[model samples]
Target: MSLSLIFELSIWITSVCGVLVALWLTWRAGKQRDLSALAGFAVMMALWCFGHLALFHGYQSLGMVLLLANPLMPTFFLHFALLFVNEGRACRPWLTAMTRHIPWIYITSIGVTLYSIWVNAGATIRLMDDRPFFVFTESGALNLGYTVLIGVLAHAVLLLGWRHHSGNKRRSILAMFGVGAWGLLLATSFVFPSFGIDVFPYPMLLLPSYLLLLVYGVVRYQILAVNRFANRALLALVMMLLVLCVIAVLGVFSGRVGLEALTNVPIWQLWLYSLVVLLMAALVYPTVRRITERLVFPGAVLNEQVLDTWSRQLNLADSWTQLVSDGEALLRRQLGQTVTIKLPNDTAPSGLHLCIEQGDIGWSAHVEKTDDLSPGMRLNLEVFGSLFASSCAALERSLALAEAERKRLDEQHLVELGSLSASMAHELRNPLNIISMAAYNAPEETRKHIKDQLARADRLVGDMLVYSGKLSLQYQRVPIKSLVSSVLTTLSTEQVSIDIQVEDTLQIDADSHRLQQVFINLIDNGLAYVRNLERGAMCVEAYLDSGRFVCRIHNNGPQLDDVLTQDELFRPFVSKRRGGNGLGLAIVKRIVDAHGGTIVHRSDCGWPVTFEVTLPPDNTEGDV
Candidate 1:
């Protein structure tokens, strides 16, 4: 083939490849609005490639038609840039109307060009070495209008790049360079010729190079969200094409440099060369694939590193505060922005927020503006948020388990202390009884003092035995009202009034002696707190609730502290009263628990203080 034909054929092949790449991009554009605009730009470029092919084949009319349509290509590119910069915001009404009219304007311009061609007897058309081209004899109104249109589109693209550069520096820089370089090449190719300048083969050859740059922009800057399989496949195809091109170049070099001796080898040697090439390709494919994957999709590697680092930080964190602090730092580093985490009970900071909740723990991350964040970064943030929530949940569960274990150990210690107190009280009781008998025969005042000391010691011993669970119950049918009345009579101090509100027939199967002790302790506690009040009185009310016998002892004393819950009230050595051993409530709780009952203090029961006890019925058919 002649050199001209060879050059033309190379242009034809490059244009065909460009068209194929354009179609592939269009097919993979999917639901992204900005990507669809990019796809439209690709299609327009493909049309320009087809036009170049037509010019090479000497189809002047078809070439003119395609070339006339090619001016719209940059308009599509500008539209894509605007949409991408705005993150696919819907265009304003006037802008939408302008977009809708762009095709009609292009069509009118093409019609005007064709009319001028026919009217002037195809004076605008010319042939250089049998290849068709367009030349303007003068700067007519149509020509000036088209130039202004291209200028406006180019300026808009530059403005978009300038505005978005700070937020997405790499993509913006690539985009600006691609647009400027392509525009320069296009002006040199077509407009310079209108001024009678010869820039022939460079224009045709450089068009393919410009399209390759565009492909690079798509791959490197990620103008679209291409899936892994499609991205890898495109890379593999490009690698294969490059390998074939290299082989062809080597063959051409050999032929030109008088290396005919190598070509004159036998047919089997050619087969061996072909097999060697294939084997080399098979070996090089994976290496090229890895490099391409790293180059085109660095976000995948970044995501993995982020997750690994976050997991390590979470593991190393000893508390929730540290975990949150580390997570905030990790997010800031990975996302390339400041991040503030607002935990439960923390004051919320002002910024764009992403809230994360795990069980009872909730936190919000105040981050940079939403528009500044890329889709990949947003996805990574979501992943990190989930991981953070999970870690917080695990930490909370671990803390709760530790607290429960501590409570168990404390209860065991209290039990041992109670046992020791009971043993010591038992040994002291024999000496106390002998002193009481000896004091009865002495003077009246000494007898009264000895009796009072002996009674106080006896009460302390009874309390220790009850707390230690050493006292046994003798269950029998007992009337509730009579039991309360007898305990009040025995312990009356005349300082606080006692009110009984139990039905005379209401009966419970419980140890009478132990049951009386529970009432005495509860009443004494109420009297101690209510003695200073103007209407100092204790009310004992008994009723059945939900198939269980319930009793509520209420007093008009100071309310329980809001900070302490009912569960805390039953713990050993915890009391709100002064000069008290703190075992009265604990012993009462043990007696109720031994009888398979639940007791809870209610500060909100319309009284300052109340203790509600619910016991299973005498013949109830279940274990407590």
Candidate 2:
């Protein structure tokens, strides 16, 4: 009930909190050597605080027992500092040398404790200005020397480690340094009462601050990889205790303002104060957590703005593939971990995975890091996965409807073209045949010109039928070089210089006549564009690559119009060349499609225009 009693009880509570912190850190240690050393340090710290408490209560024998054990406190701290710097890396020379001295320090501590016992030396509780303080005898100086030696050595090691480390490790070292310095300063102040300095030793009552700093290191800098749930619970517990400790200290100090006021205050009033503190803590906890998240563990919790942006990007994706790729990239950037998104059919990459399914869509997302994801991150990922699945499902349905409409339109177009082709063949080819027969009876000089006109008209009719009609392939093993050379021999080569790069033994299984048409159309385009030059350049190449037959026709002529879309470039009626129906490439495209091949336009191969035709391996064969 007295002010002194209240202060003593506050110290007792703080000592107990230190023990609890020791247990918590020990539980978190796992198999990590650095963490084990840290747990050991915490244990010694708890014992040191307990030793002071025992001395204050006049338990001389028990206090001496604890005091004898206190010499190992600095040893544990030094070992912790050394192990921390060496974690996940080879030991540095300075740390290695420092580590070599640990056993000697341990030996010296034991010797000092024994000497202290032999001399009957330890601190005695004495009243200093009506407050209990520890006063040490001269023989206790050996203990002080031992403690100071180890404390200085540990701090020096921490300083070096801080300078040598970077990022989270550096920050962790700095936190430990601050805590160590405070502890050392407090330990030094304990010797002041022996010198009659009359210091109140208020630093001893602030022992809980050491535990708070360590918790901050674990939560903020990730000194220990505790999960988000545990972090929150531990933080809440520590904050509540801190608030109560602050309140209790205030209650004791208030007795100075009105000595008789709190002295006669009923015990129930104190209980009422504690209950109100608890209620206030509940109300303040959310705000405290927000501050802690923003300042202490920044970026660990994804904010609404980030989640909203991620969702928006995911919804904007046009296909399931795009959605998965973008989602993984976003998560990788946000979490600083390698992320993978696996569809139901995709093999999952190695790591911890979260499977999410929405509607008929399902995928698993994972990070390469083996550490379990924090609760906030895991929840964010799940939400992201759900949003991605829903968006992908909607996109899939939309695409399916669009594809169906596209196919229907294609079928209608094909029917119209078939009718048009039949009409053109019936209406135009008969007149071309009659013109050819009439040209034979004309005068020799005039008959030559008429024959040329008749031939040109006949070729135009044939191109239209090929463009609109389906191809029927007569498969044969066609030598690629022989086919290309035969097409080139049919065309006049005066205006263009041509290069052929096909191997004589290279062959493919295709319709020989239809395939020849493919080459003639492609080679004629190359010659038409290069006609302005006295000898423009062109090259024809054929080869097998990756189980597919490839032929590339390259020319130094002007490139295809950059403004044309892929579909427009292959349209039957589209032509940019003079005196030509645009049916040459269109017919080529039809024949290539019937043979299960792909054609691509290239501008990246140092050519003005190039068309690459790639046939499916099934429609292709090795050399004959």
Candidate 3:
């Protein structure tokens, strides 16, 4: 009924709120830094409010005992500020040493205050309008100085850290300082009452509000990685505390003023009884919620309707690209974040990620970690990502099956074509040999022209048979340098300078005749390109690499056209050179394949054109 009682009741309710915040911080301290210190600060603040409550209720000894909590309150506050600003990074050496020694200074101040209280020299209490004022002597006044000094220092640290940092860290520190400023002003007002001042700690009424802002900071800015489930339980606790406070106020009004049947019972004891009930409710909230959740929504991470809607949206997507886009949009819309869906091979940007895996398929949904996102939201994201990955797996299987069928058809067609071409080449070679015999008997000038044309036709027919017929190897120990030199002797290399880099001792088990054809085709291909240069040059290099014999023939000429693919270059009748049959490289490829070797076109190491041949090691081997 009285204004003083109204103020007292408000302070009691908010003090309980502060204690709840301390419990929440303590719960979160394991995963976050500076939270333990903040929890200590909250506890001290709650004690400060209760101490005032005790003094007003005329419990002098208990109130003075509670006042001992004052010295460490700002100490914990400054410690939390320093840690919050540094943000888990190592602080400056001077600041570290200062933080380490600050608590001892506060402890000594407590010692001096204790001695002052023991002497009981100038400790006096006066009553005005049901509010008790404690008059402090010089020793008691020391607490006020400690409060001012440490409180300013904490804010100063916060300001400096906010100014010095950039990007997200700067923004986080700024948010902390902004929320903390309100609590700082209200907390400082409590000091006035300790100095025999008329201040009633009305700021205590907003203690619950100040604590709620910190919770908002934790959820919105990720100042702490608090558990979302715990957040829900804590909300339930706060609500119950409020309900209990309301019930206590009604009881006081009903009994003392309205009903008058229980007028003998004191109002302060009723509030105390309410406080005890609230504490018990806070302790049992988690157990109660667990029991209730099982009865309501069994085995569910979040609201089932929301999860089902997200699942439907994902399943209805027409394509993978659309699915990924829609899923990212959903996350951004619900969580208020910058979201990206990363394919398996994509590099994920730095952030919080919900990784999804279904069998061998895997990808991630990424978001900037600006908040402790709820479990319900995370479960929804996981469901979306899992569906996307599943779709990718199914699509990949379909493509693979189609590709396999296509390759089978291609191989079958090539085999039929090769048989027909081989038969044609054999029949044509017979007529070419007869023409060579007739040309030898003609007149000298006519014979020379006729023989040249006949020889060209014979070479083309021989290439066709070699490329389209079955190739058989006659494996023997062949020296690479000798084989390359023999191939060169059969070619006109007078206009080109050839460099051989094969080791003298290098030998491999391969058909010498077939290997000779491989070099002749490759080196001739290089020479045809380079011989036109003013100072033509070419290099033939061979070595053993990883149990395979490797050879590279490079020429100083213009590189191959970009439009030409390796497959196209090796196919029959796909020549880039003038007046060529084009079966030279095709025959070369067939021979290499027979010998368990591979040939590829390259332009590397400052060479304009190169053909690299790699062969599997056989019975005979020598290191280069």
Decide which is better by lDDT, 1 or 2.
2
Model 2, range 1-624, lDDT digits (tens) per residue? Answer: 664565577567757766776677777768766666767766776676677667677776776767666678778777877877754443587678767777887888878888887887766655643544556678877777787788787778777777767888887777776766676665565667877776666666566666656655634556434556557768777866776676576567767877657656654566468768777988998889898876654445667898788878887877777877787788788777766776666676777554434443343333334356665566667666666666666777888998999999997898788789879889998887788787787899899988877777778888877776666677888899999999888997786888899998998889899899999999898888897876699999999998799999999987788898777887777889887788888888888888889887888878889999999878642221
Clashing pairs in 3: none
Residues 391-479, candidate 3, lDDT per residue (tens digit)?
Answer: 56655566688789999987777677678777877788788778878777789999888888887787777776677665667778899
Model 1 misses residue 88 by how many Å?
69
Rank by lDDT, highest first: 2, 3, 1
The local lDDT score (0 to 100) that residue 494 gets in candidate 2 is 81
Estimate the lDDT of model 3: 0.72
Off by over 4 Å in 3: 31-33, 87-90, 119-128, 188-201, 214-220, 223-624
Error of 2 at 230 (Å): 10
* Residue 270 lDDT in candidate 2: 63
TM-score, candidate number 3: 0.43
Q: Which pairs clash in the backbone of model 1?
A: none
Assess each prediction's global lDDT (C-alpha) against the native.
0.69, 0.74, 0.72
